[model samples]
Target: MELILLCHAATRAMKTGHFPTGDEPPERDARAQLASLHALPDTRVIASPARVARETAAWIADTFEIVPAFDDIDYGRWRGHSIRETGEREPEHVAAWLADPDARSHGGESVAMLAARVAEGFASIDRLDAGRCIVVTHAIVVKVALAHALRLPLASIYGMNFAPLSSTVLERASPADTWTALNFAPYE
Candidate 1:
């Protein structure tokens, strides 16, 4: 089975440096990126249960099938706060959150939790029914998925950053299967 993980289109919140709450509009560059991804051949299309993710998937598929399991990490009390503001107001929490993969200092989901959720979401997809699927979700979701696919520690999520509309393709024949390729580029 092939899984194409596409981070949601760039949101105005991303460009403006604010935590996204699924209400931001897609930026110009993100629209172009979505158009580029849409040209790929048809496959099963799934999206996280977020407005931004659903809108992004709609760019590539006729129907927007919502996958609640693939939803973005809960930001908790930090939702809608700018990074700078969060850091300034809660420096120690921010520090711990960034340094500890299991830390939920921000009162949100930990990196470990995000990785587990994304892995569970992928595992829930039936390879026999749909061998190939396109999953549109947030950058954090993409990062967590990548860490799971690559068998990296949850902290590795911090070492990687995904751009809007970036795609990471992973494939396996079964639930117990190992990755066949790391960073797959379909167009190339």
Candidate 2:
């Protein structure tokens, strides 16, 4: 099975350096940015429940299943705040979160928690008999997926960057086989 994790298009929060609230709509030209993407026949399309993710998926397919496991990490009190602002306001909390995958100092979901959820999401996708699957989700979710597929430490997510509309491909011969990262590229 081949899995394609597609990051959602840019949103106002992304452009302005604010942490996403999971409710922000994609930028006005988001669809235009994804105009080049064409879904292959027999591909199963899935998306996070976030508005941004659903809108991005719509650009690729007329219908897609909403999967809660692919939902963005909860930012809680830090949502809608600029990274710099959050750091300045709660340096200790931010530091803890960056240093520990299980830290939830901001009262939001921890990296470990997100990873678990992403694992569940992938498990369901693996159950599908489709030859290919496209999951439209957030950058963080994409990073988590990559780390999970590669069997890397959760901290590895911090070292990865997945631009909006980018796609990361992973493949496995069967449900019992290990996943392999095939490619990572941004759509032009």
State which candidate has the highest lDDT: 2
Expressed as tens digits, the lDDT of each residue in 111-177 for candidate 1 is 8888778877877775436767888888888878887877888888888787777788888877787
Q: lDDT tens digits, residues 70-182, model 2?
A: 99999988998999989998999999998788999989899999999999998898789899899999999999989998899999988899889999988989989999988
Cα TM-score per model? 0.88, 0.95
Query: Which candidate number has the best TM-score?
Result: 2
After superposition on all C-alphas, the RMSD of every candidate to the true structure, in Å, is 2.5, 1.3
- Go through the candidates in order and give each one's C-alpha lDDT: 0.77, 0.90
TM-score of 1: 0.88
Q: Look at candidate 2 and tell me the lDDT of residue 76.
A: 81
Q: Which window of 10 residues has the lowest lDDT sum in candidate 1?
A: 179-188
What TM-score should be assigned to candidate 2?
0.95
Runs in model 2 deviating more than 4 A are 32-36
